[model samples]
Target: MSSSNSQKEILTLIRDVSTEKSQGERRVVNLKRQIEELQSELESVNAELEDAKRLKECTEQDLKGCEVELAMNESSIQTLEGRIALLQGEVSTIGSDLEALKVSEDICFVAGGFRFMCMLIKCLCFEIAWTCWFINLCEHAFRMKNGLCDDFIGKMFDLNAMIRKFHQSVDSASYEAFSSKAVLQNVHTENAHTKQVEEGKKDLERELAQIISDTEKMEHEFLLEQNLHKQVRSSP
Candidate 1:
């Protein structure tokens, strides 16, 4: 009976060793599967990170472009402001010149001045008319060249044009008023010059008549002296 129990014990030890080896094989297989799963998850995460990096670079480039556009817009605004200031200065200078022209009412000619007055008035009218037409053309050209037909651009031009038109109208009215005043003064000067010329012509005619009368009187006195000498010689 003791020999039989030892053999049974040895058989039980062999069976237990076979079962543990089988469980160890299953654990190794599970570990390998888990490693493969972890490796796949790591690869997926790395791919996602690379895609995010590419998106970040694209976003940065877009932002840089936006900044550049903003800078360009700011520079354009500054240039427009400078142009407006220069235009204002030009308007002011034109206004002053118009005022000076309005105040200059002195007549330049005094004697024999009818033809002269006609010529002067003709020249002044021609110059003023030409200047007004030229200014109108210049304003129109500026509007066209500056894109002033657009609604937004037209707004700037409208403000400037309105101011210019208002001042120009005032100046034109002043010029007209001065012209009226000058007309009366010029007429008076011309009349005075005409009267003086007529009087001088009459004086010249009177002097010529007196010289002819004196010469006729001298010829009559010499003829009377010659007749007295002839009578004296006949008596001898």
Candidate 2:
């Protein structure tokens, strides 16, 4: 009866051993699936990071182009201002010449009078031409200033907004990468811990299997001894 009870216990142990092995296998499979998911997330985050970098580079290029254009516009404004100054000087010189001719007319001899009349006519013509030229210069200066002002204002606004956008994008991309990296690190740490636990469980299972094998061998020896005793008693 004790032998039968011992046999029953051994069978129960075997069933428990099998169940533990299956559970271990299932745990390993679950861990592997988790690792795969984490890896996929990491790859997706990296791709997004690369795309953000490319966009930032493009924005930088655009800003550089805008700066060059602004420089050119400033140069044009300077040139126009210089031309306006020169036109003002020419108008002043014409006014001085006209004043001298008036003085000459008052001091007249007949030849001097004739020469003075011709000079006056010439001055009048020059004044008309100078007035037209001065008006044109003023118009051109106004146009150049207005155009440059508008262009500078518009370009500056665009550049500033773009720069801010680029910075925001860079910041956002960095933040995303940092967050992903942190998650990856956490997943890796969990995997490492899980692997260690799995290794420990395997060791424990191996030891348990050895113990069960030894117990089975001992149980077989006990059964053999019991059968021999029974045979001896029956033969007597």
Candidate 3:
């Protein structure tokens, strides 16, 4: 009975040892699987980190480019503003010059008109003198041919008076025409000069408008770029 009891105890010990060994092997296998899963996760995390690094580099490059573009836009805006100011000053100068030119033209026109009127009056006087001399000669010839009579003499005197009256009227009409023509020409020249000045002013306005439009466009682009830069800086 003592030997049987010892054998039974030995067998129970053996079975316990085998069961513990199996459990230990199962635990080792579980640890290996967990290690493999951890390795895969680590690899995935490393890949994600690489992608993030690349994204950061790209974002930095884009920010730098935006900064450069913004600077250029600012420079362009400044240049355009300067141009607008210069054009405005030039316009003012042009206006002053035009006013001075108009004054000079008016002075010149008055002087020229006076000289022309004097020349016309002198020509009329010369023509009247020639006509009077011709009429006197013809009257003398008629008296010599018809034997100087009172009736003929009276008729000749009446004719001489009528001729003198006609010549006076002609001289008055010619003086009026000369004055009117000079005034008309002066007005026409002034109007033409004004038209030219207006056209030049319009051209300057158009150029200024174009510059302003370009400046506005650049400002808008700069604002958008600035906003983008801010967003990039604030990004996580």
RMSD for each of the candidates? 41.5, 49.1, 20.7
Residue-level lDDT tens digits of model 3 in 63-169: 78877876776676566567656666765666665556554434334444454566568667867886887688677776575565666668768867876876686
Tens-place lDDT digits, model 1, residues 162-217: 55765575556455444544454556446654454454445445554554555455
Candidate 1 achieves a global lDDT of 0.59
Measured with C-alpha atoms, the lDDT of residue 227 in candidate 3 is: 68
lDDT of 2 at 109: 30
lDDT of 3 at 217: 66
List ranges where model 1 is wrong by over 4 Å. 97-236
Between candidates 2 and 3, name the one with more favorable TM-score. Answer: 3
Instruction: List candidate 2 stretches off by more than 4 Å.
Output: 97-236
lDDT, residue 74, model 2: 58
Tens-digit lDDT track of model 2 for 1-236: 99999999999999999999999999999999999999999999999999999999998997787667556555654554555455555545545554553343221232233334455565567557766765775566567755576655565467557656655655554454335433443453355434433444454456555655555555555555555545544652
Looking at model 3, how many pairs of residues clash?
A: 0
TM values, all candidates: 0.39, 0.38, 0.48
